[model samples]
Target: MESALSHRRFGSSDLMVSPLGLGTVKLGRDKGVKYPKDFTIPDDKAAADLIALARDLGINLIDTAPAYGRSEERLGKLLQGQRQDWVICSKVGEEFNNDSGDSHFDFSHRHTRQSIERSLDRLKTDYIDIVLIHSDGRDEHIIQHEGALEALQQCKQEGLIRAIGMSTKTVSGGLLAAELSDAVMVAYNPAHQEESPVLDYCARHGKAAILKKALGSGHLISEQDPAQAAMHFALSHPGVTSAIVGTINPEHLRENAEACQRALLQT
Candidate 1:
């Protein structure tokens, strides 16, 4: 099979990206919360090695969020000198304070600006490749969040972000976002096929559709053989430009890339 990373293009952006993007949600959280058993959060050095390895293997797009504990900061430290070559996508609207406390969502213009600034400081980058509004699939929130949307547009105009998008959990929310934003990151997989029509709608409007939870948040890939099957199903979807997979293990990353190639061939 050919290298899946060679399969590129993210929406209408000129930036070419790997079909399998790196998701950094786990990187910011404590291992206990993310995984049931004992799992180690890799140190800065180890994480840097993983980042270097991923780039070496041709994986370029990295998705992270401020809500993910120290992920943006850790990735910033790991990719210190070579940030320009990769596409860094981060989300705003959610904030993580303490591990024990409930997380909060603030999509106001003030909070949006503050969130983007904090992310930039943590990422050590002047401009983010993409900044997505992290919405939890609530129509009321979308309808009431005009200020945040305006702020995001302002940020784009100011050159703080290359593209604007929304990360949604529902097909309707994704469709709504696709109508307003330049791209969308949605939970899309064979297990949840309802979002396919939304993806197609996004494609028709020239908006990029980025797949999240492509492996059902690790459930689909809990077994060895099924991992490839799940990934193939995701990449084979015509509406998806790339599928973001989260894994600290380099071998699993390679498997995802291979699965993408198989999907491309079959499609």
Candidate 2:
């Protein structure tokens, strides 16, 4: 029988997360997404069902952020009784202004600290498993000038977050994030392999590397199912700890999980 993929220890953190983390961007916002297709936002019940399915399929890492519409709130409610079953990861520095259908980022110390506090309250939890900086493509500046990293490190020290990381966008930024953070999220897909060096560095340094947009953000060019190929590519790299993919459809969830299983077998 096919089963959910195995887990990996996330960097130096105590968190042992699933190899395929469920990204919750579509759970909260569908208005200004980069998905090739558009679909209606799922109701709270639907969201709960998908989360339940994920858990049933052995997905333990749930990735969310303030920029992902009401995902944090929805997850707070949907996962009320089963909080311990999953390791929740959220982000700071970016906010989705639903009114304007636009986004704004604030990496100041005050905002960074306040956002973590707000996330705690919204998620109905006392602590977050992982907190990453939601980079706005300006990864280096955000990591340097902005106080986001300091705030996250402070929160980590205070026990507000178990681990600190950055969703970096560049090779240099990824390397820097790995040097400073316990985990670093990078974009890697079959079409692009430029970021492989970052992954290599992380592997050598014992830092966790999380892969984002592994399937080209669901904009795959090939007609065949890319789930297996994407998972293969993601896990093929020794540095990658996990791949985060956002999908609301149950079929996609099953397909992705099975593909991860097959990829693991191949490896």
Q: Give the runs in model 2 whose Cα sits over 4 Å from its true position.
A: none
lDDT of each: 0.80, 0.90
Residue 227 in model 2: lDDT? 77
Model 2 RMSD to the real structure? Answer: 1.1
Q: Best candidate, TM-score-wise?
A: 2
Off by over 4 Å in 1: 1-4, 31-38, 221-224
The residue-by-residue lDDT of candidate 1 on 171-223, one tens digit each, is 77778888887888888776878788778896677788899888887666444
Measured with C-alpha atoms, the lDDT of residue 25 in candidate 1 is: 69
What's the TM-score of each model vs. the native? 0.92, 0.97
For residue 105, give model 2's deviation from the true position in Å: 1.0
For model 2, how does the per-residue alpha-carbon lDDT over 37-116 read when each residue is reduced to its tens digit?
Answer: 98878998888899988998889999999999999998999999999998999999999987777999999989999999
User: Which 10 consecutive positions of candidate 1 have the poorest summed lDDT?
Assistant: 30-39
Q: What is the lDDT of candidate 2?
A: 0.90
